[model samples]
Target chain A: MKLSELGEFGLIEIIQSIAEKSQNPRYDSWRRLLVGIGDDTAAWQAGDYIELATTDTLVQGVHFNLNVISWKELGWKALAVNLSDIAAMGGIPVYALLSLALPQDLEVENVTDFCHGLAELANQFEVAIIGGNLASSPDVVITITIIGFSKSNRILKRSTAVPGEQIAVTGFLGLSSAGLKMLQKKTTLDNETTNILRQAHLRPTPRIKEGQLLLQRGVNTAIDISDGLIADLDHICQASKVNAQIKIDRVPVHPLVKVYSLNQGVCRGQLNIIAGLPGSGVIANAD
Target chain B: MKLSELGEFGLIEIIQSIAEKSQNPRYDSWRRLLVGIGDDTAAWQAGDYIELATTDTLVQGVHFNLNVISWKELGWKALAVNLSDIAAMGGIPVYALLSLALPQDLEVENVTDFCHGLAELANQFEVAIIGGNLASSPDVVITITIIGFSKSNRILKRSTAVPGEQIAVTGFLGLSSAGLKMLQKKTTLDNETTNILRQAHLRPTPRIKEGQLLLQRGVNTAIDISDGLIADLDHICQASKVNAQIKIDRVPVHPLVKVYSLNQGVCRGQLNIIAGLPGSGVIANAD
Candidate 1:
């Protein structure tokens, strides 16, 4: 069967089955593991804290077009996505290992610029770039593995959203999708709105503080919206075994997205779900 | 200006410089970090034990050829290479995260076969497949990030080899290279010899127990021979600021390699350095 028929989640299930089969009770590492295979990050008990690990990969032409996004922004987005996963788990990122597969003829300056972007974000979060691997490939592929820490009791998860709990989203959504649309169509808009939308798609802010705040306030369920509202919500629903109802009017859309949507024949108060782009979408559940 | 011109080590230097610049004395993680970039793994203090993390990527057509290797072997090799890095650090691998970029049209059985290989190796080490990312790409790219643990005092390093210490190899060298050559050339040999050589190249074992034993024996410097004898020894020499001299006659070559080498018009006492192949070449230094 083709991978397209099996789908991503189906593929994940296959891997998870193999992973689960290997969990021997004899291994002490299995005893310390709190979460594995299916969460934003795999978490394990480490002394007084829970260690969180997550990996993300970006392949050229599939995830980003070099002509559309700068190498620095690509670097920023790559790490940012992993940061968002940690944030979703209510953890503080500490270290990262980057593995890069680059074309042999790619410019050295591009790589340095990529590192600069990664360092700039890493420095902000106090994350150390520890170690990684470099390989030669036909196209650029960047895979980042990030490790983080969180309080054992305060860890947020996608599988614990209680039924009838109210969901609250941090920051505006759909702006990134709109920004991508504008870039694809070369839409002419006001400079401020254009910058806002473009930056929203190109560079996203991970809700690290907001995630911690949510965890502190006794919110236990959270997921980063990398795959838009519907898909991400489906992940929570599937993991938590609960149905969700999102009021289209209640979903927050960025004003810039609204402006862009208006120019593109979309109605106000419509739920604009940016299906496949990493956008400023952080959602949490509060009882 | 190109990546080829800068070379892998030069690019790594640029990354390490950026990483070092971002290291703030104020961050507590830095205080706990014992080793960062330029080593087999990055290590940091995690309570009483030191945590070691390493990442490796295998790109299709560059690091592997589908025509030459099965998907299951590819999976085993991907994890095996990372395991070797952890082994070189004298650490016990505990957890792993896999990031895979696969072609959309790839067969589902191929992925399952790959995972079967990974799970088989992972179970042997008692390592948990904690978390990872998957994306669609034009070709298969597998990057694995493995985390291991070692006692703080027992951690081995490549940079600590002394001036006059004798290097002891844990296993035979040049077998994997010979295996690869045999496969590439489609050389017909005795079935037993061919199987031995092919297995060495396809399923090179990571010397986890050997590494631990070396550490227990107070051997503080070690390296795995992934890039053959000359290149790996060069790494130790560069890192330790010492030159090395290997007696060609003293370097151990497998009987199979010797047979193959003899057929290829090489002397019995000649040093067969199989560069750029993951092989059973674990070398350690004891005072």
Candidate 2:
């Protein structure tokens, strides 16, 4: 009965069931809903455009450590993760709501630095931080809800992938997980490699443009590789009702992750394919 | 420099400044944005409709005690608070994203109960729980983002109040705070009063229909009295650049709260006029 037994996905299933059953069939908004609950984003029709909504939360000790990640990096990653969800749907993020629970003793600079980092990224994509809530808590918590929109014809969904399509990724994989390992273990690497991996983990660039490009080229299925490569691939497989045959040797592995794996005596593939390890790579399904 | 030293409002000022400074004027969404931070909800033009988005966070211990509040009540309250924000905007809530950080040792029933409570309230308003994120944390953290919309002409904003408008609330005040005190202090009251006060705190109804009616009646300025009467009135005053003179004798107080206050030897007005106590009453500015 413990949450540890049910796990995150299990808990989501329970909540989703309640959500599905709780909806009033007579409600007018149901007419506008395109997708709900089980996807990178919930999407609905908004006149000529399709609106997208997704939310993500980061806990102080569970998601990040203050020692390993800078306050600014924390801010950047929080927004980046939500942006990735929109990117996966081939949507342009338009606005965000940031809710924070901070310890009372924390310094103001930490919050301001976080805002600066978040705003810096928001400015890049032209996304606005519109509204939010702040509360006191024992640990630092940040939850961001991102609202995005796409041209109705161009929006992508994992359920649209055909059986014979090809699966490809936008960027190198495993560097984030490798960087996380290095940071957690304090494994020393060359300055360039450390910066590459750490930045990959801490300051990922959401593939907003790449996703749009994919959709323009008629790719209709895609997801962000935040929950590792295989897990995300499985999401597409389940949603699209298809099977995937992976050529393990062909999987793109970052050279930095390879070096770290070798230095730490861990298999590069473990870093590359395992579940739970996170990355910013975009997995796209194309004809 | 500490968060306590700056307080919530001071920190909000710093964040609002950063958000204002960071927005790119050239972005396309900016042209559609009608309101951003420093409001009850962030709103923008979405085709013929004006879209509204608001987020609220509830932290255990800070917002509620599990010993005093049931998990179902927690769920209802979490969604109700966000719905209150949408109501304050005179918008109909359509969707929500729930982000929860819960202890791993917690029971599955607890989560399901929370979802049931949330879904029950959401069902009443025909709002869908579209998407969300879940994470493990030491404390229970619930953050909900509600998305709503209104006819462009029907939307309300706190800053729209005019100097000659009269300010009045939709319902009695201080019941929630009084109920909270009764529960927290274990005050022994008659069964009827106890039930009334406790329910007021635990299952306070959101004034969604009342808000829509206000908007229908051309009331363009309103806010939920979740931050007590004076503080919320101060928000209206500050945003609209007007002042209010409330007649203390005319402020509506629940008879149950009065009874509880009298029993506890506390002044009823203190409970009614304070800044931090929360209620579900909608304060309206009408001509």
Looking at model 2, give its docking quality level: high
Task: Put down candidate 2 lDDT per residue, A1-287, tens digits, no spaces.
Answer: 99999888889889989998966657866768888988889998887778999999999999999999999999999999999989989999999899999999999999999999999999999998888999999999999999999864567787777766777898888878888888999987889888888899899999889889888887788888787778888777777777777766777777677667777998865675643322222374210
lDDT tens readout by residue for model 1, A105-201: 9999999999999999899999999999999999899999999999645688888877778766878878777777778778888899889888888
Clashing pairs in 2: none
- How high is the lDDT of residue A268 in model 1? 39
Candidate 1 per-residue C-alpha lDDT over B99-216 given as tens digits, one digit per residue, 9 for 90 to 100 = 9999989999999999999888999989999889999999899999999999645688888887777766877877777877788878889999989888888887888888899888
Candidate 2 positional error at A82, Å: 0.5
Which segments of candidate 1 are over 4 A away from where they belong? A266-287, B266-287
**Distance (Å) between predicted and true CA of A156, model 1?**
0.5
Q: Model 2: how far is B263 from its true place, Å?
A: 1.3
Candidate 2 Cα deviation (angstroms), residue A233: 1.0
TM-score of 2: 0.95
